[model samples]
Target: MNNKTRQFFVAALMAASLGTVIAAQAAGAVESLRGRDVETQSREPGKYATEKDGPPIERNYVQQPPLIPHKIDGYSITTNFNKCMDCHSWTRYRETGATKVSLTHFKDRDGKELSNISPRRYFCNQCHVPQTDAKPLVENTFKKAEGLR
Candidate 1:
């Protein structure tokens, strides 16, 4: 077809698609669960039971970062201050009985090691998450590693 004819057909097709969507929305045909059980169910309180010296959880897969085993309720981790470093830094771990931050945390994106935790790895929460005893919000079908199984 000619350029003008092809453009006209494309514009008409777009208009038809938009009109169909508008009509469906106006007719209340859009699927929504605004007042359904999933939406209206009473929410449980946010309290979490923390385990400080509990048995270590097995990693689900290889290279899975270990979950935090203790509560970090009042810890501050701003650009200027990382409370986790007080216990987990290399200099303090030996005395504080806390695990040392991984050597990888000291390396930058280029793999050059620094005297301190790399900027990229300074945020402990990015990889380490505290464990909670709360029930799963949804059913999970995850399987553990072969050795764990």
Candidate 2:
């Protein structure tokens, strides 16, 4: 190999070894499966407000699914059971004051109608998400569609 290429590789190896040694000495940190020091890339979770039950947030676009207006931190949704259906199901929403599940949720991928929520749409979190009182992590120029205004 040329002298410059050989020197670059040697320098890179030295830097990597030095980082590993320093990390080990500093915190007894372990190397990840990818050979990175685990402590080198870590951050605490961001704080967010505990959202309260409220009216549904307005959608910014035509096809946007409605956002959950309440916190669902402990709600359970498994293959055999869905806690969301307890209140949002057609039979219960009216009595519970919760919005009814959309009619579209009852259709299969092939557009065939079903008697119950389709398996593909049973997991509400896949499309519906709750909003939090957190500041935007970055600035953006996003605007609602003109028709929505």
Candidate 3:
């Protein structure tokens, strides 16, 4: 072949080889997917933020999780759709000494009243959680009356 044709063939091969190297380099940085076993994946365990890790969103001073100190795993204290409600439900929790769900959970989204635990209350973690080991976003000396000492 003439010089021009030979040069063109060489350039094409060089481009193809360079592309292969780039693709190989990119594969290393890719996230290595773990096995399908749900038990092992981070998502299977579900992540939670502690009060300290969480941005200082103002909580209803009167309403809060009474006993839990860590993000409750998605175990339902009561038999129902996954949420923290299983123990907090009034019907079953009293025996367990778990804090009974608040009375307001009985209200429906439309403001209708129903007896027993409200279906909307099924999501227990929506409001209550345990303390977390994290840094406070900002500093404050505010304390409860007892803490003043």
Candidate 4:
């Protein structure tokens, strides 16, 4: 209502508006590791060599989830159906020549064992990726544990 009060409020509002604009511009300048705007949809998958069906790759460390050795393109792994189970299920692995789903996969988060793959462990690709020809985004010098070597 007073001149000084009105002037102070106006100055504060303009400063806040300027701050917001600067922040938005800064955000837009940042690119994600995938080399795209953070908010954008991921780029289309790139062409990578699909590894042929083979024996399981050796683990680099204890307790590492095994890397998938075969191409799994078009595999369906939904809540109701898991294409992987057709070959990797305990009942089918022997005949299919696919590695059986790990025994650990049957344990609940609470450590109780179930008769089938626990829901928490049902999505295989969540932790396991098929080995491909794609290079790492960053360089690393990691090595296998001495025991594994």
Model 4 Cα lDDT, one tens digit per residue, 40-129: 333345324545677677899998999999877789999999999999999999999888998999999899999989999999999998
Question: Which tens-of-lDDT digit does each residue in 88-143 have in candidate 1?
Answer: 98889999888889998899899998998999989899998876555665799988
Count clashes in each candidate, considering only residues at least 3 apart in sequence or on different chains.
0, 0, 5, 0
lDDT tens digits, residue span 60-116, model 3: 344444445434544665554655445556666887566566767778888787785
Comparing 1 with 2 on TM-score, the higher-scoring candidate is 2
TM-score of each: 0.62, 0.69, 0.43, 0.66
Cand. 2 TM to true fold: 0.69
What local distance difference test score does each model get? 0.77, 0.81, 0.55, 0.81
Error of 4 at 18 (Å): 19
Model 4, stretches more than 4 Å misplaced? 1-47
> Cα lDDT for residue 130, model 1?
74
By summed lDDT, the worst window of 10 consecutive residues in model 1 runs over 33-42
Q: What is the alpha-carbon lDDT of model 3 when measured against the actual structure?
A: 0.55
Model 4 residue 21 lDDT score: 81
